[model samples]
Each structure stands twice: as structure tokens, then as C-alpha cells.
Target: DTAVSQTPKYLVTQMGNDKSIKCEQNLGHDTMYWYKQDSKKFLKIMFSYNNKELIINETVPNRFSPKSPDKAHLNLHINSLELGDSAVYFCASSQDADSPLHFGNGTRLTVT
Candidate 1:
């Protein structure tokens, strides 16, 4: 049932607002992660969780928060969105960090 799902494949909003993206996976994997890609398509890790436990936490801003509701769900919450926040947010997972990560199609976040 969980094949890494994220809502709003595309988001368009002006600067200075709050937005949250939802994600869920049914792979029964232990680890889930969030990656952010800039306009040029460079990906960077944002957060990761294993079996509902926080694992990898990247150097993201306080305005950005990632929450894992369980081993099967990881959601991203952003506050006071800025123009720089515009990028692709991808939800990924694997058995562990050493394993290859499988990513969703991606949510294109466009903050104006």
C-alpha cells in the first residue's frame, strides 16, 4: 500500500507563507528520508528516520521541520516560505543509508 506517496506534485505560492507536504510509504522499510533539489536539480539530504526514530538530520533552517509519523510516513512542514524554498522535495527510502534510495516522482515547490 505504501509506495512512497507525496501530495501536491506541484506547489505554487508567494513568499512569506506556511505550507506542509504529506508523504507516506508502504515498502515496510526501516528508513525514510527527505531530499531537496534546487532549481538546477542538485539534490541534498534534509532528514531521515528509521523505524520511527530520527536518524539523519541535515543543516536545514529552523523554518523547515520534518516529521515522521511512523515507520511508514514522513512529512515535511515549512514555515514562512521564501523564494529560495522553491525546489523539488523528494521522499525516499531504503533498508538503510548504505542501500540505494528509492525516490518519489518529486514535489515541485515554487515559492515566489
Candidate 2:
């Protein structure tokens, strides 16, 4: 079984389009997170959910939304996608905030 899984491993679309990526984990983790990896390979935390409570990083834009239905799932929604939004989105989970995160393969979104 996969510890973490994210759907649509690749996404290709034009600017202004809307898209969503789904994620699920079987590791029984308490905290799940969404991370964006930019072209330079910098991974930045966008949002984190602990037991269904949301914690958004201040630097993240409003266009990016993260929803966790339960402890095992976290989904990402992007509205009015921009060229700058093209990056690899990774879904990760950890037993707690201090534990190491196990990441999904990543969903690479490309905007034209």
C-alpha cells in the first residue's frame, strides 16, 4: 500500500483554467501538507492540516486552496491558474509536525 497518493500525476492546461489535485494517505498520520516545488526546485509549504484544522502559510496566495476531508486525505484546488503556478505539487503526510514527511510522487502542473 502507498503511504501517500496524489492523483493526476501530470496536469497540462492553459492560463486562467482551474484544476484540482487529490491526495490520500494510508499511514494514519495526524498532519498532512501541500507543497509546491518551483522551477528552481525550491519546495515551499502552502498549507497544512492537523486533525482537520487548517494552517495556511502566510506567503501562499488565496488562489491556492487546500482542503482536508479527514486525517487521511488532503486535496488542492487552484483557480485562475497562472503561468507562474506551473510547478510540481507534492502531497505529504507525517505522524506529527515534528516527524518526517512521506511524499507522493507529485503532480506536475504545466500552464501554457
Candidate 3:
């Protein structure tokens, strides 16, 4: 029962609106991350946090921010969402970079 989970499997939103995606993991992993898979299926890391400390922010827009209150929970908040932000957002966790990630099914965000 300890697996990564994200809310709203699909989101159809209007541009400029703000939205938040919540994620939780039950695994004992110390690191949690946010990745975006574009329409082309290319996955890119957006944020990474280890033990509630953010360690990486990969050139993501300022409007997109990730918050991890605890090792098992990380939430993403986007302000003034844009059309270019449309993609599948996946929540993942792993022991470390060398370890394989356990990914959530993903939140398909469509910004109209």
C-alpha cells in the first residue's frame, strides 16, 4: 500500500488559473521528485527533494514550485498556469538517484 499517488488524474484548466497537485508516498525513500512528461513522452525532472530538503530545481519556471513538508509528501503549486505547462506530471520517489523510481500514474494537465 506504500506507493506514490497524485490527485486529479486528469485536469482541464484555463490559462492563467492557479492549481495545485498533491502527492504522497508511503515508501521509506528519502528522496521525492517531480517530473514532467511532455506530449512527446520526453520526461524531464522539475524538482527533487531529499528528506524534506529541496536539492534540485531544473530551470523550471518560477510559477511552478514544489513543496515537501515531509519525506513522504511533496506537493506542486503552479501560479498563472500557461498552455505550455500542459503535460503529464508524475510524482516519484527513490532511495537515491541510482535507485529506480516508483512513479505515480501521472496528472494529465491540459491548459486551454
Candidate 4:
């Protein structure tokens, strides 16, 4: 069983459209995170949710938001998606910030 899973492995949408990626982890971790891998393959942390509360929010745009209904799930919602938003969004979880992260296969988002 996959410890972490994300829906819609591939997402293709036009610019200005809004879309969301759903993620879930069954590892019973205390922390969950959202990472974005740009076209250059640089990975950056977007958000971190721990114990049902948002903990770390990087310098991400206001258009990007992370919503967590529970500890096991963290969803990313992007509004007015731009061409710059086209990238692979990965969902990850770990016991703590210092712990190794287990990442989902990642959702490839393409904005044209």
C-alpha cells in the first residue's frame, strides 16, 4: 500500500483556471507538507500542516493555498493558475520536521 497518495496523477488546464490536488497519507504521521517542483526541477516547500494546524508557510503566492481537513490529509488549491504554476506538486509526510519525508508520486500540473 502506498503510504502517501495523490489524486489525478496528471492535471492539464488552461491558464486562469482554478484546480485542486488532493493528498492523503496513511502513515499516521504528525506532519504533512506540500512541495512544488518547478520546470527547472527545483523543489520548494509550500506549506506544512501539523496536528491539524498550519505550521510552516513559505514565500508562496496568495493564489496558492493549503487546506487540511484532518491530520492525514492536506490538499492544495490553486486559483487563477498561471503558466508559472505549471509543475509537479508533491505531497509528503514525516514524523517531524527533521524526519525523513515520504513523498507521493506527485501530481503533474500543466497550464497552457
| Top model number, TM-score | 4
Name the 10 consecutive residues with the lowest summed lDDT in model 4: 45-54
**Across residues 1-105, which tens digit of lDDT does each residue of candidate 2 receive?**
988999999999999999999999999999999999999999998888998889656488889888888889999999999999999999999999789999999
Model 3, TM vs. native: 0.96
TM-score of each: 0.93, 0.96, 0.96, 0.97
Per-residue lDDT tens digits for candidate 3, residues 37-90, read: 999999999999999999999999899989888889999999999999999999
Q: What Cα-based lDDT does every candidate model obtain? A: 0.89, 0.92, 0.94, 0.95
User: How many steric overlaps are in each model, in order?
Assistant: 1, 0, 0, 0
- Off-target runs (Cα >4 Å) in candidate 3 are none
Ranking by lDDT: 4, 3, 2, 1
Name the lDDT value of residue 3 in candidate 4: 100
Question: In candidate 1, how many Å is residue 4 off?
Answer: 1.3
In Å, residue 71's CA in model 4 sits off its true spot by 0.5
Model 2, runs deviating above 4 Å:
none
Q: Which number leads on lDDT?
A: 4
Which 10 successive residues of model 1 have the least lDDT summed?
Answer: 1-10
- Relative to the true structure, candidate 4 reaches a TM of 0.97
